[model samples]
Target: MYESFFGLAREPFSVAPDPRFLYLSKQHRDALGYLNYGLRRAGGFVLLTGEIGAGKTTVWRAFLEQLPPRLDVAYVVNPKMSVQALLKRLCESLQVELPADADRPGAEADLIDALHGHLLLAHAQGRRTLVVVDEAQALALPVLEQLRLLTNLVTNEDKLVQVLLIGQPELRQLLEHPEMAPVAQRIVARFHLQTLSRDETEAYLVHRLTVAGLTGPLPFEDEAIRRIHRLCRGTPRRINVLCDRAMTLAAERGQLRVDRALVDQAASQVFDLPGLRRVGPGQAARWVAGGAAAVLAVFALTRLLPPWQTAGATVAAASTPSTASAPSSPSAPVSAVPASALAATAVPPSPSAGKHVASAASPASPPPVTASAAPLPHGLQPYDSQAEAGDTLASQVFGQHLPESEAWTRLARRWNPAFTPTADPCAELPRQGLRCHSSQGGLGPVRLLDRPGWLLLTGPDGRSTRVLLEGLQGDQARLSLANGRTLTVPLLKIAPWWQGEFHTLWRSPPAYAGDGVLAADGASGTWLAQQLARLDGGPAQDGAEGLALRIRAFQMAQGLRPDGLPGPLTLMRLNHATGVSEPTLAGSAAAR
Candidate 1:
């Protein structure tokens, strides 16, 4: 109704996930990057959670559009299906043929077989299969278990099917349940979408209006924007609802622009508040006249008081909250909902709230490693809630990579004095000639080490999962999983969850009792120069000054402390950069 009044071509505040009006905030961009990482992985699980109406669907749609043609995607918008029903749906999605003569169990078997065949064909053709289950939080435990079992269908190196699960914040909690560890352990990439910030919310509104063919200034007054933001709490859906109602009310009042009064009146109507009733223009005029008279009376009374009393009265008046408007706070980007807005009241906080705060980082104190991304090793998958893959992790790190169950079997058979099996995989790394080093700030130190390793990903419940780092490619890292998949994640995405701990296998360095010096014309310095030159594509030189500058420059490139000294972190990275071939006794510890 307000489209023509505001000179818009169409409704600007529709609550549809229209890609045309979608705006990518920083969080959204991060979420998309995670999604892309999931897609690039061979096959595993990608878990995405958000509060209701945080634009998960919009981001999903945008991601789907950009997916490569080699990937075939099947979307499950409703996840409340039985195992058999889900199997049938999967068959329908993948276009697998099912025979009519089969019973429910038989049909399920048929569907699985057909899907396996189809996926194998796709694999042979160098294609990929993805099944996206939306509203996954509502999936039954049995069905989730069934989905986990489906991931068991794999080649020696990759899973036949990749699953993408999208749901609300509740899904995160659901995954934290001990019963869901099997499913939870498969998630290689997880990202939670947050609500828009105040600025993003304002930009979202303007972007919508412009998309709806409004080329002039925004129809909303500055005060109206603040009122809307306060009521909507930076949620795009609620913002749209309040804005739509505000515009409707404005059109009803025959106004060309929406102001604070219209927004308040619209909020009252939208929220059904008993104290805030919509009034007519005549009533508003009378209220303004009455307020003016009251102000004049107060001014006269204040004039009779002493100067200090008058100033005190002025301060008190300023302290009073105005019903007409709210002073906008310094725009906080966090997702918060004030109780005044009925719609926003339904939106929950993002899972892992405030975990993304960059300010929590300190240079001296690094974060802890809380999560891991090791995929399910075959033969030893944890079917029970209490089962820990500690023995398997030991085998993967120390012994050869065996399937989870097989790894346990191998651990028992090849038990060595150095290997003590425990439920916690990372409990006893020191015995295996390895050490766990943690840095607080970021990946600069990790990159300086530059070795394939595992990260302990901490969940909200304090349980840690292991994430495997296969290699680093510039600013991103190639992470391998137990499910035979590899994810290329940007360092920025990892920063949010990285607790600053670097855990991997490192050989003990030879004893050297000198100040950490890596640049000189000596044997060690010449080797360091040659390694740095080879690693960085520069000319090999052994001069102390030139090599020190090169070392500093290399440190800077890896996001590490760029001090000129080739410290332990730099030496470790250089040792890894140069393959371990005929290593000098002192430098041999740096080799993986």
Candidate 2:
């Protein structure tokens, strides 16, 4: 309706998946890169997940528009079907002709044979076949198992079919089901597409408007756009819904531009709120009035969202009664609710006790992974009943609480199998082709470093305890304790107690000795120069050419101090950037 008045070719804020309007924000770009990389591989699954309106479907469509010229795609838009129905749909999507007898509902074997034959023919003709599933979280276990079975249809040098699964964050959780292990193991690439940032939110509007043929300045004022970001938390679809309404309101009022007041007015109408505050997805409209204090507490406590190693799918959670008590072991159910749904943190007293934390990520919980090993020492559980009173696992005073040696050993095992429990684990690293790295920072930098590490969580008293942060996804953290027990907890509860100290292990580069300063004329320096060149897209050098300056520049960019030394942490980051083969968090390890 406002297109003519705004001088636009089309509606700028339609909630549709159009490739032209795909804004290449850093997260989007990261996801797109993984999609492109997944397509290049011969076989395996490419899993992409996000919130309902987080632009996952849009990214998948963009991937389609950029499909390899020689690809045969079997796209399943809705995967909530029986295993037989799923197989039939894949056949229909890929144009694989079904036999007359295959019309029977129970002819799954025949359906599989037909699909295998079609894939083989396609492969022989030098074509790649890919199966793409949307809303994959709705898929049944047998359906998922069938998808894994499809991956087994292979010849030498390549599998006959490659699959891409796109769904909400729970799809990530669903894959973690122990029964889904076969399919989980085949995921070659996985990325949790997150919402845009504040800057990207603004740019998203500009890009959409520009694509819709706007030649004039933006219709929404700066304050208006910022307000929209706060309300929508940078979710693209929510941005579209709000902006569409705001523009329509402006157009009706015969105004050329929108302001903060106009945006708030639009939000009130679109979200139907008397006062429009930060409207998180899945949050109730009632929260706009009663949730302010709780929102502030949780927002300020703003827990560490690990680099989407979100359960690195298990990073998800839900609500419970005051009587909820956690199981003594990881094997038993923590609650009727999954671990992802349960907030491990103390709920700061709220005006309405019925409300949950607004900032808490609401990924659907999958079945908790059952640990066959021993439980937390003395039956200490992951979710404590006293957590609401600030007595979480980290805050507990257990008689058999893990000592530093065991913590160091658990941390060491990620890198070195032979690593033993010791007070000085750093001294044991050199002999294991590894190096010890420590740093103090918030979760963002540690996530940027993106290596699993040991977190020193202190209790109410002055004493500290060691916990292994093996997986981090959104707001859920999978922590390993001394007895080899693992459990997922909300980062919200843990963030307040942390004072920013951590230690991780990194593999040193070739010809690099575990020693003091890396000499400029030494082999290590030459290797560092080449790695830097790979990242900087510059020339590789055997001789020093402003090598110290290059190292310092790299350090500063990576949030490290501007020291020229090539420390183990810096090198590990370089390895990550250059796509070196190394162990990642559990969430990303399988995909890598």
Candidate 3:
């Protein structure tokens, strides 16, 4: 309903786990890495455990996206089946033929044979095979044991199949059972998926919105984002639900932006807080009567006390002088108090004596004691000012230079966890204190002095170089080079003051300078050329001998045969040292 008003192409906050809408946070990336490692390292089981709606399936989809075409993949979405049935399902997924009357053992054998054949075929074609089982926690022990046994199928060099098991945290506990230890021991890689951080939640929202065709700033306010973070605790599924409800509420009310009130309302409705429900007039009267009785009882008790004690009661009552007046008669109108006022006055203050009341009423007296600071909700750590400063520095760097590259944006995402970018990187990296100058020099070394502080240099050739320096001002800084060109540095690239762990780290080699040192003798003599290339400047002689020396050194460092014949590895290493990728050789049998 609100889509047209906001100019959105579609609802941006659906709870469904659409693969197209998958956003890989840091935790998601780590989980995917574990999955990839497990499958690539054959002869073992890889386990991925996470809480429900933690995006395990999304990571699985991402894994499938990056899989090479040559590899055959079998995915088991449902794992609640008998051993025989499970084997049959695997066969069906792999498209293997089975006999019409095949029983348990028969089906198992046929499936194994088909898998073996496929593995051999894939190997011959320079490929691999992987089997992914989702919700493996539901698999019975017997079925899990069978999975362990399947890892036995292997050649002398490598395993014929790789297995990935993905499920909830219960899966991990299940694997700890004595009966499942054998299977657990076979796991080569494992990662537990976790919820996103507060900043990550914000980024996730913008990413989804942008993907859904949102063109403006995020509809949610900062407080709304924080509220969603608190409510969902960074779980992608919960965040989606909350955001969806908030958007719906905003649209219904004809609001362009979803504010904190809308978010709180949605949360209260969805979570069903009893206190938030409104009471009718009859209920309200009863509540007010009960409150009045309690107050009168306290007042009667105070009246019976000595004058000195009663003075405290009187003072307390005076401190909270009510603007409400008593009804003149039984037929007089009853004043209706606002809910906000009632909420504010629901709790009574402790009684104090007349002396305290006089002090409070004095013109120069201080205000009543109030809470100095609100405690952060559970599970939240206090914000680190240093980290925030560092992020500010890094944001400035990218804001000024390399604004168009996705890699740069990813860097910014890492540096400032709070920034959420849609499709356009332009709006994300604000241009503050950003200045750029073109230089004639090649890419210069990037140094991080402090977070949000950076100095980037680009050579006369227009190739850029990045360095992050600590203690920079604003989100951008400018440096003038010798050739009358200026370089722009974004603050996001700035390194934190404490990140300098290695003051003596080796410098990156100068480009193309290592190309001229090679020796002619071959594998036995390449090491000498490497040492010569490491020397300060170019060799005294710029002849064929000098070039041969550099080549020998490059070949030796790269572990090549080093015949000094300029082989692929030798040229490749030399190119890498010079910051270039060697082109593939054409018409060469070895290259082919």
Candidate with maximal lDDT: 2
lDDT of each: 0.62, 0.70, 0.55
Q: Per-residue lDDT for 1-592 in model 2, tens only?
A: 9999989999889998987798766577567767765665668999999998999988888767656568999889888898888888988988889878876868999999999998888888989898999998999999999888898888977888888999999998899999998899889888997888875787688779978998666788656877899889889999999999999999999999999878888898888664455545444443433344434433343354443333322212221211222212222223432233234323222212213322233455433333222133223334542245544565442313677667767777766666676677778766666677778856645666777788877766666667788876544566775556676665656765577787777776667667745666677777877887775544577456467656655654454555667766667767887887555663434211
Superposed Cα deviation of residue 192, candidate 2 (Å): 0.7
lDDT of 1 at 367: 40
Residue 126 in candidate 3, Cα distance off native in Å = 2.3
Candidate 3 lDDT, 85-180, residue by residue in tens: 877777777776755655745477666676677667767777766788999999999889888877777777877777889999999999999999
User: Which residues of candidate 3, in runs, are more than 4 Å off?
Assistant: 103-106, 268-592
Query: Given candidate 3, what's the lDDT at residue 265?
Result: 83
Please report, as a residue range, the 10-residue window in candidate 3 with the lowest summed lDDT.
583-592
Local distance difference test, candidate 2:
0.70
Each candidate structure's count of clashing pairs: 25, 10, 52
Predicted model with the maximum TM-score: 3
Whole-model alpha-carbon lDDT for candidate 1: 0.62
Off by over 4 Å in 2: 277-592
**Candidate 1 C-alpha lDDT tens digits along 336-355:** 32111111222232322223
